[model samples]
Target: MEGKESKTACSEGFSSIRLCVFLLALLALIVLAQLAQAGISRIWAVDDGEKVKRIDNNHPLATSSDNPVRDGSEVSLFGAKNEVSANEDGRFVVLPVENPRYRGNELFRAFENYYSPRVRELRNRYGLDAVVAGETDEWKRILLLRHWIKSSIAIDNENPTKTRGDTFAILDAALREGKFHCTHFSIVQHAVLNSFGYVTRRLGCGPGLKEDGGHHGVNEVWVNKFRKWVLIDAKYDVHFEKNQMPLSALDIRDEIWRDGAQSVVCVVGPDRHPMKPDSETGKSETRPDTYRWCSWETSTNRFTTFPATSTSTLIMLQDEIFKKNTWYRDGKPHWAYGTPYMILTTRRDWIEWTPNVITSKVTIEDTKARVFLSSCTPNFRSFQTKAGDDTWRDCSEEVELPLAKKGRNCFTFRTINLFGVAGPEHRVEIVYSLDKSEPTTPGTLFSESFDDGKLLNRGWYDGDVFNISADEAYLGVGCIEYPWEKGHTKPSGCSGVRHLFEPTEEVYLRCYIKLSPGWGWTNRTYHPHLMHFLTTENGKYHGPAASHLTLYVEPVNGKLRLAATDIQNKNAPHGLTQGPLRGGYNGKLYDSKEVLFDDSKWYCVEAMFKLNSLDVKNKRPNADGQLRGWFDGKLVIERTDIIFRSADFPGMKINQFLLTPYFGSGLLPHSQTLWIDELAVGTKRVGSVSPPDSSAASATSWGLMLERINQHFPFTFNGAADSAIVYANLKELTSP
Candidate 1:
């Protein structure tokens, strides 16, 4: 499974001064070793022995001009603040004489202390296709670098006896031990940006609102383009932003204090906790309320500046670097120039929704609907809208309108960019007039999506197991979260959404899902089933299984694969006692290796289970029962001549649609999460793509922004040889 790698080693303590000296020496040795293998003459990216193909023949990077004279008109286009310029393709170059107020090189060495071999080797293994992971644009490259470094290290809470405050020593010690915490996280980010000639500072977040009582740590970096200091929470791997542009601590405090949640646009990472367990299921899936204790996502009471940022500096520098933007007009540096604060105003655009299904905009005769949100410049980072009286979240791309809310419902959404700039508010009104609706016919059923931030108000219910979540989703707005304990192993970890289906000769169902990366390996049984159905004796809610069918995903030979199963025996239901689950791999498991399932990507999984004749006397009813599966619109698994049920017991109808999308137990080594969307079942086949393609996953302006961002930061190594290496040990994308 593609997940965070757990790696840590106990560290031996050292005095701050001694640790700094030792780490610098070690870095020098590593540099010397590389020079020995290649040479100082070659401006290479890594010590890979092969001569890098330089982008430009004439020394690729721009050399410092001999005269070092400033051009008056050049400042607006070329960045030469503090004697620096965009030398070539967004890379920075410094003039001969360093600015008296800057300590760029000194900070560079500090970054070297933490850029260990493990970092480089990982980049090499992944090869050139890692720029998307690192990025090319200097500012966003920092974001990607921040994400990769943090994602590589899992949280290790074992308190160390002696933790160094010096940025270089702290980062070295953290990397050497492969352990991470709030401080270590900040150090890694600080080191990387610091190495890249960006002035970065470390700080501590207060325990409460008092800066002096800080318990958590964060970092800040000076973005030359935006010409501002941006606040980044390395622990959460997120940064605050407004209007899609990044924001600083003072900016965040002032805007939030002034405008409250409206000033805050969106978080760049998973900065919120999963929803609280709404109801209860008598299973391991019931998470303790303590799960809500996700401190990283919560608002910091106080933002405290770390003393190391000041004391660790190599020279006595002016504090102006933290405040002013450098503007050169008429061949002179203008340090006092101010840029107007950017804010989004009112937006004028309309959205489209499906009329056939339930939508916030229209009263639907059907169970589902899709809506389209307006676009933005740097593009929509997320949305902030109400669900319940108070439920609001930074929603992603597609939002499923709440059908349960009758009449007209209003929702305000805005577009956000990486710079933390949020665009104008686009208020949308969903009109659901229940009076004007079409009647339903036979061979039809309903669908449910928590996109509206409400539970199923229709026939389906949580059955006391799942909680509605806004953080994760495959499509539309929301999906019910299948929460479970940290280390409990029981079949109870399954999703709690339940619906007793009326009997039909054949029922076809399909749902989009984003699987947990740690699912397959964390599950003891190599195979794990998610959606299962059985015949309820009372035809209501109770778990009575005379027959059953299931669809799930699993790992086969290290690659994720889709699979299915069934227990068609009599009332005993193939010796069923263990919560309606029959023999493991009862028949030939249904799966296709040609199209492996990806945990990180969304897939439309569907299954068609047809019932056998009730008159069949034999246990293995051959002719009538059948099963077929489709993945992402492609047919993968099929079984004809199967016994899904028997005659004597006569519970032929498929009753309970157990909304369980989970592994066997809750005792998982790693906590994982997934999302299910567009879940529906009817007598006819429902392929991955509906007629006219009702997919909300179509590309958008935000998608375009991310595309350009990825292009500039392609997930591949672009041989843009930096003078030396910074920690390249990066993110583990998707499954192996």
Candidate 2:
């Protein structure tokens, strides 16, 4: 066991003597800078053997071909002659970034691209470019750049602060304000690292194992030394290491969840110990049988990061990465559109080839503009356009499909035309249903066969959505579903599992749900609690619940959505106490803004909740917990900061897995019923057992990282799957 730990956890190269010396030198510089802390805002400079060059307004370096490119004459800091080609300001795009975000090396291209002159100017005044230029080790260069970013961009907590336009404009804002936030800090680091030809990406971080799970911004540099991406949190002036090896955002997420928080520690922070771990269910709770819904949203709640997709997300995206939102898994949606050059659209659910299913004709269509519809997969295969609304001619010659796996198949095609206009690559996900004729194994987590006609009482309990019927079953004689009746208004029933007999850190729940022919027939409205997590006192039923988060099937803004939200704190008064409506913390609405769920289709809905521990620093009410859900293995909604309690409320815990299908105060558009079968709750990944690739969702670079993590990490590795299916380009995570 110790040997295994050495191979995976403890073997990262943080203990190298070279890095040790460099860190010591950097530490001394940090101390000296601290002594001159008063000038931190006014002048952020670095020693270049002879003088410290301040990057304030007094020292100006311009890159405008439209005007003079310099106010002061350039000086040789590193003794290397510097050359920069000037270009128009706003047209500069950083990175020309490749997909599989964390590992891409856009730095060289970005530094040499049109943005080079402006970037070089910024680098010269700051003086770190010379230091970075002198370093041969990518790792050391990253550290040097990290120190400058931390030293230069002071954290701005004041709200009156404002932002300018575009990436260059934001850099101007940062220079002017002198003070910055975590967002600006990463932006500066990204530009500086790229300037020195070190591939860099802005990575988003969520709460620690404790705390309110605030959104934090960190940067990852593709280090040649490690041959992999490593994290740098300039805000803390530290990086994360496990067994002394640097970590990526994914690594941090894995370590925090898989094995608890023991091996995870900060590289250079006052709190270098493990951030904390998933806390147990709080004591002093009530019976969940009496629990009802509570509404909450925090007006003053601010700390953690929000996804770039959300309108409420607060971050300055002046850099190209921000403008493009490439920090998260982003480009998977275009796969359905065939190829950009093809410009195809479809009414059929992406290429289905499963058992007992007919190859019905699926409508395929295309429009001029690639809305780049957000999907678990890509929207188009390949793409390029000469002029808007003119002609989007197909140039992708085409590629042949690969052999299909026994269970599922996937295909992709990419092309770059002679004009250098690249096409959006096509990614295909097709599931060849597992052989039902052969013996089917149970999912990695718990599996239920309703043939016995009752929920196993030991770990599972009966709740609101519990009605056994042999009418239609996935396998056994019985499948659970809402009582089907004419004009059913408030149909609600449920069954739940207490706590896993083994681990409690993270749990993935999977179940087979089939809408009755009545699924959405009422066509009026559908608010079905496909499932809900209830906080229990002792893993058993606790009542008058203080916390609960739920997942329901409802039509939101004309789209059928699988939404997730929990009970909000009533006393927090974040935005709740307006008048008669007394609000507490706000519940995050898990809407991916995509409508993929349809009725009458046998769908597998899976959810994983990594219960976040309560931290002393971020006390009461405010919570940034994680709740992820997938339909047919296609990610539909994700919520990282889901509030379930208030300052006085207890820690957020999901005790009861309630399959509550109900409409609170209104009736269904018409009488309608919902059906369910084969429910499961376990510590392992409980994914789709049939058609639609469970593994298909994970078959990418992100999937590779999750696989490597499961093997490279110790036995404490939390869940087998790194995350529920996410539709974006970069990998999405739910961490401590």
Candidate 3:
């Protein structure tokens, strides 16, 4: 009996061990399932107050790649690899591509007008900034400005000012006559909003085609806070809203059409109280039915070139029935056809477009995600980025964010304007895995150090007035020198060299140079042409001043300057967007604000030139070309919006480089000699050079001398801090 009992105990113990092992395996499976679920790619948009909404993968704003093929070492989130499927996992992702409907459209190019002198004058003349100084919220400022305009100018539709779109003229007439029309109020409000760096458009609204002369004019301002347009009727001191969010004209029209205008609320006055029928007049301040038909100008730059209308008018119809009828007996609606040209379309995007919204393209390489951001923000300041739960940090237009290897990673990007207003947020999320492929580095197209003391040996051509010298070199024992006679003013005294390479859309040039003591500038705007890039559309020996496209990099009056001229394209069908043709030479000049070069010391100067993208299908040229210059490792000048070519030269590229130094006829201030060395060019940025100790005599000697002085006379100085400051200021003034 004892033997039988012991055997039973052993059998029970074995059963209990088996149960423990099964439980451990089940728990492991559950944890693995949870991790796999968390790794699934998901996108979310976090708005103000941390409101998060999950966006579906099939949403118009979301784009994904199920089997992302590698482009070099990086995987693009769009293009041929873009495919969406529920079964496919481990995909690369990016969010909403910039709406192509507004990409390069001219009607959307209103940001440039904010820099107009007229806009600035209007802001200062009326104390517009002071009026909204206490308001931190951008929407509140918009309401405040509207109230100011409504209170300052009374309404009188009978004797409206004849100075239609001019803000100053309208205000002058209102001050004298004490009243103006609704059109004048909208014009004034549009100008004021633009002066404060807000994008606004004037709209003319009526009940429909049947409404004859009872049309009203109002303004629709882009509120970046909500990432939508809000209609404000300054003349009536009212704006439409639904659910606490401001409604655009189209929104109000849609709401009224679908639900009988019961949901739409009309808010009036600066206090934002609900609209009620006047106690004496027995009429509401604003009616929602007025937005049944809307018309607007294509361009918001009416105040930019006052008294000269350059934009077409577009009218939006509610349905096809309205399209067939005419508002006027002559079949030409005066309100819609007021401009030189007009178009009627039922497309809502053409009438109501959103601006100041951030759009991005993303790529994944290993554990890093690169985000390229673009926007139409006015009065642009800087871009801000947030990674996961991290704090928002200011970043450049192009930023690289890190991704977690084991789980989900998210990033958000937005634009901040100069007035401290933040635009809509663009978010991207991805599940990362390691990519073992090696990244490729850009190869050098051409390099020259003059260390071999030979210029004719390389692929250099047209070498003249330049010879290799062994004295005062920046990098090696040899450098190229150019000597100008004391009183010489002829082109023969200039030095030049040309190098041709494979055509490329972008190029960077870096060189170390030193000007002679007391080197003077050609005080006039033109001349002393230094370095130039010529496109393949021009002949190898074509003059840089006139070509299909010629980019100039030079120092003008001690300031680094980057300029472009396309005289060969001046007569193209598109017309010259950069010039007015001055004596067979015309171009736009971008000068650096700081004096970068003033002393006889070796300085490293680098310039980057990138051609703008072209929309061949639409036959339009985008004004997004870039030109940047750096002096001694510090960026001093940058111009992102430049028109380097027209559609006529769609295949243009930088094929030839010229290092010519010449002053225009009788423009050379004095005979000056300069030295050039370590010239390098590449498709990617050929960064600044670091000189050896022996070559960095000026900077090294000054720093050492200051340190010794501080060491000996410690009481006379504030220790290392004061000595460092003096050393830095003196270095900047005496050297590069």
Candidate 4:
């Protein structure tokens, strides 16, 4: 629901001229540089914590007299490469030199210092309070801060008439005009957060391994509970969609920090120089004569450069925050420098998994365990990590979360049962872990249901997080309810009466299926349909129904293919498939291959449509020339022509589709599976797919220019303004 608003008209095309120009400029600049090398050189630190007194009296590392000196000796810091001086007061002094080589460090520092007083003043005048309220949790607070920063700063549209000045003036103009660059966005965000008493600092920017070669910006904030600074990328937020992620989440972080975390960096065209060389540091890479510290984060940062939404930007932002301190730092951590290469390193720290205080009483009976425990908090972003694997999976929930105990609220463990307790006299074991990763196919941790006696809703015991349901369940990119609730429609465009249910010990192999025989207008009856069942256990795929259970049903085929064989328990990690399925069968109603339906009497159906020939192009008509309709043991209709086919995703090739309608239950008295015979299969694929009829004459296929102009206005007037009407009548360029 939140991601639906992000759909926008796709842009037409790209410009090769612009790309060529950018590449040429970058090549020229890199060629101009005297040093062309790779790998880490030496690291130099300028730790301000160990304050320096003064700079060397005689110019040694210093190239300018304007450089600040303290204690008559120089010092080094973590990020900045410039020489530092210690004053007589036992405090280190580093003069803000002009045109520094690595502009990111100085710009970040200037941004913080220059705007601190202004930020304070604005807060007092507007009573906006902290950008993020203290009462909010760390993740929420960070999210709020991100939203404020991203929404407030506008992209800088450089006007031909305006003269560029200092970062402050430029940022102010951009903010006033509702336009800002990347650095401007970062600077504003940092200053604003600092004013709110947030521990914030800027990361480095420069060329990256990605296609784009422009200035990048990353930052950090101290998470209270973690008591550590987390990395952030303000530019990524501005560039990409803050809602729907277009690129990989971690890729955005690598663009800013460039520690091999991301594979690519999305950036706008044209190369920009790094910080100008300070008169002090004699190290000159790119000459200062042609370079200017243009805050380009506005149009060409990782997030903004990509065609993404605000939520996607938020996902990337979260990833960036976590990427910091992923690795350890060695020696005097050299401050990252250079135009496009800002080296970043960190030490990995241990993460804690605080267990839920509410104890769950799980009855482990016959290898089956049922636990009803409500976790105090449902950390929305904090997910479960499966044992043995370095990935995180999704879980179902009932309420809004990020579950840490809230005030006056008690957690009630909602009971959602799981079946199939295998392994004779087994011992139940469950562990919990949490981390971050891409969200993928998520399932539960059970084997089979006793009532259905068929495996439908199976789960896995991944030692990390389990897919515990508070209420909702997974359905594609969104979630759906178990039973069809009022107004709860099936996935859009899905045909037939879809009865999706979670089978339990009481309702095993039970469904409402019926059929009608003799084609054409049957006067009183209709065609036939069937329901199939498939089974899975522990998040992995097992063979067809492995249990030898008795079934009772009205005969459809010869005698219902009631008994099954070749049932096996598969434990291979890759073969497991989880979902609404029980067993497999040949549910054929079309073609001259299978004669499943016999008498005209009503009968139950259960079978799997082995999706073999899904070729959209090979659509051929049957004998009657009425589009193929395999139902009630007959090919009722077939068509000679098809509307359209998707050229992009051609691999809809299915493996083995199955179905088996059943009767009679293992424990429940009312449970009964009916005869399964005329199982039908056609060209339709499960889940959402393009319409089968996308012909040129179709309304959807027609090009529509739903264009609008100035749809809303503050004022309405005819002709000209009242005051300007008189002047317009006499004015004709004064005819001079």
Report lDDT per candidate: 0.42, 0.40, 0.66, 0.27
Q: Name the lDDT of candidate 1.
A: 0.42
Ranking by TM-score: 3, 1, 2, 4
lDDT over C-alpha atoms for residue 691 of model 1:
17
Give the clashing pairs for model 3: none
Estimated TM-score for each candidate? 0.38, 0.30, 0.45, 0.21
Stretches > 4 Å off in candidate 4: 1-119, 125-127, 130-135, 157-171, 225-228, 235-736
Name the regions of candidate 1 deviating beyond 4 angstroms.
1-443, 452-456, 490-495, 517-520, 523-527, 536-539, 542-588, 613-620, 649-651, 665-667, 689-736
Model 2 lDDT tens row, 208-245: 21223234555666554553557676755677677878
- Which whole-number lDDT from 0 to 100 does residue 412 have in model 4? 26
- Report backbone clashes per prediction: 46, 68, 0, 111
Model 4 lDDT per residue over 136-230, tens place? 55445555666655555554424221424233454456556546555555555565455544545444333322332334445554333332344
As a whole number from 0 to 100, the lDDT of residue 134 in candidate 1 is 41
The top-ranked prediction according to lDDT is 3
What tens digits encode model 1's per-residue C-alpha lDDT throughout 567-639?
Answer: 4432454442113444533534555656355444567777787766655455544456677777777777776
Whole-structure CA lDDT of model 4: 0.27
Q: After superposition, how far is residue 243 of candidate 4 from its true place, in Å?
A: 15
Return the TM-score for candidate 4, rounded to 2 decimals.
0.21
**Highest-TM-score candidate:** 3
Q: Cα lDDT for residue 79, model 3?
A: 24
After superposition, the stretches of candidate 3 with alpha carbons farther than 4 Å from their true spots are 1-106, 161-165, 173-177, 209-212, 277-285, 307-312, 315-321, 328-340, 379-381, 387-392, 432-736
* Model 3 C-alpha lDDT versus the unseen true structure: 0.66
